[model samples]
Each structure stands twice: as structure tokens, then as C-alpha cells.
Target: MNLDDDPPPTDAAAALRLIEDQQSATARRLNPDARLLYWPWGVAWLVGFGLFFLRFTPGERALVDLPNWLPLTVLFVLLAVAGAIQAVASKRAYGQVSGDSARRGRWYGYAWALGSVGVYAGLGRISEHLPHDLAALLWSATAVGFTGALEMAGGAIWLDRDLFRLGVWISVINLIGAIAGPGWHALVVAVAGGGGILVVGALARRRQRQRQQP
Candidate 1:
């Protein structure tokens, strides 16, 4: 009896059961819990932009009296943490999988990278010439707008209505925030944009649980 040799074939029914079991296991591993996917960004946006609001209020004096650079630095740090979490989660969900879905995910990731470069690079020169408040508004608005648009794109690719609606909501609020100007923009995004993402994450968790139930 050579251990390396193929085992005897199972009947069709047994083979089917085996396939089903494998699929179930794969699904269990690959389930993209939206909470995990969304919560970190929610927290990042909430805290980061909240800080921004405090440090850069429209009045002559800043509410928190923070150094000019602190809020932006903190925001960037939190965003980096959130991005890392999302990357890890995505890898766990899709690393072993391959096909059209995987290909789409890869392309989408590239889009994020490339789009971010384009936005920042396009703004870099102009930002240096703008006034402080205007620069803040410009940077925040463009970043938020790009993010919302990408979210909509992701929703379309995945055919998820909830995600699509969330993207629309984000874009709308981002526009309102920009219209409101610098300090107010941060406040709106901190409350509405971050808050909305958190709410959607909760709802997605609920839906995922319902689908997993017996």
C-alpha cells in the first residue's frame, strides 16, 4: 500500500458532499465581514477630522490651540493605521482565491494607488500657493471626493446596493462640507461621513449574520 498512490474513488453522492463541505469551509474563511472592513476607517475619519475641526475652526483662534501641523499629522497616522487594517483584512479574505473576482480586486487596489498619486500630485503645486484655510479645504475636499467616488465604483463592481448608497451619501455630504468651508467641512465629515460609515458597518454586520444563520 503506497501512501502516495491515489485513494479509491468515492461515489457521486459522496463526491458531491465533499464538494459542498469544501465550499462551505472556503466561504467561512473568505466571508468579508463589513464591520472588519469598515470600522477602522470609521474611527479614523471620526477622530482625525474631529481633531481637524478643533484645530482649525473658522474663528481667529483655534478651539484646541494645537500646533499647525499636529492635526494633519495625527489624521495621517490614523488613516495609515486604518489602511493597514483594511489591507490585512482584504488579503485574508481574498489571498487564496483567484479568478475574475480576484482580478477585479487587484485592479481596484491599483486604482486606489494610482488615483491617490494623481490627486496629490495634481494638487501639490497649487496647494503651495493657496492660503492656509483654502489649502485645507482643497486637500480635504479632493481627498474625500476621490474616496467617495471610489467607493461608488467598488459598489458597482460588486453589485452591492448598500455600498452604492453609502458612496452616494458620502459624496453628498462631502460636497456640503466643502461648500461650508474649512472648519465646518471637517466637522461635517467627522459627523456625517464617519458616522455614516459606522452605521453602514453595523448594518452590514447584521446582514452577514442573517445570511450565515441556519
Candidate 2:
């Protein structure tokens, strides 16, 4: 009955507990209900892009009576605010999964998404003060930068690389097109740059769903 001679049994028990914890974590990852929550947002993007893109003109400035860029700026700031809220809520919801180490901090994208909102908001203000085209150029850069950060986690999960690369490309093209200002070049940017992000976003979303499947 000497406990000092029972080291092997103690080690085996500890190993069993570790295995159980891993299994529990894996089960949570594959939850189907969580996967289902991702689809409606994708659908909304498809609709928004399809309706507005073909006819979108720069400086349309969706905000009502807030000056040209003011409206757009407001929209972005609101988005940033919304993102900040979501980021906080998600930490409460998903707990540690909201941090990195889980698919490179996919939840952190929520924060980055909000950050894009700020960039556009700044651009909106600048556009109001400066020459129309210059304001647009700045806005475009801000928009792309925010978009890239949001996509970083998404790309890691979906593309297996940094999503920021796509962001850089998008920001660069948007910057050029903003400077180019109007006509076919702008059209090309709208269709290509925006569309590319939408497409890749859709695919990344899909990968997220599949990962959660049973």
C-alpha cells in the first residue's frame, strides 16, 4: 500500500485528463449553430454590391445633408463605433477564442473592420476641406487600409497567408484610381478592387463555415 511506488498510475491519470480537455475544445470548434450565423451577412454584401456597384459614382456621399464627404465620413465613423462594440461583445461571447492563437485572431478582425470605418471618416472630413480629387485620394487610402486589417484574420483562415497583402493591393489600386479620378479607370477600380474583396470574403466565409461543420 505504499503510495511512493505508484508514480506510473499517477502519470497515466494526468495524461487522461489532458486528452479529455483537448476533445472538449475540439467539439466546441465544430459547432454547427455558430457556423449558421455567418451566412446572412454574406447575402447582404452580395445584394449591396450588385445594386450599387454598377452605378456607383464617387462623391455620391450617402449621408443626407452633411456636406459631400461628411456623410461618407459619418458612415465610416459609425461603422468604427459598431466594430468596437462588436469586438467587446465578442470577447464576452467567444472568450479566449476572440484572441490570436485561434486561427490568428480571427475575431480581432471585428476590431480592424471598425478601424476601416475611422479611416473613411477621416477621409470624409479631409475631402470636405481640400480639392475634391485630393480628398478622394486620401479617403481611398484609408478605406483600403482598414479593409486590409479586417481581412488579415480572414486570409489566415481562408488563404493560409496574411490577408494584409490583398489589403495593400486594394489600398494601392484605390489610391491610384482616386487620383486618376472619374471615367473608365474609376470604373475599373470599382469593379475590380471592390469585387475582388467581395469574392475573396465570400470564400473565406465559406471556409469558416466548413471548419465549424461536424
Candidate with top TM-score is 1
Kindly list the per-residue Cα lDDT of model 2 for residues 1-214, writing each as its tens digit.
6668655536777778767767655755533332233233223323332233333345554222333444344435544554455455445555655334554555555565476576667667668888754554455445544565555545556464425555555666666755666433335454656565556556655655555443
Task: Determine which window of 10 residues in candidate 1 has minimal summed lDDT.
Answer: 1-10
Regions of model 1 farther than 4 Å from truth: 1-25
- Could you tally the backbone clashes for each prediction? 0, 0
Tens-place lDDT digits, model 1, residues 15-120: 7777777776666678767898888888889999999999999989888988888888888998999888888888988888899999998899999999999999
TM-score of each model, in listed order: 0.88, 0.46
Scored by lDDT, model 1 comes in at 0.88
In TM-score terms, candidate 1 sits at 0.88
lDDT of 1 at 129: 97
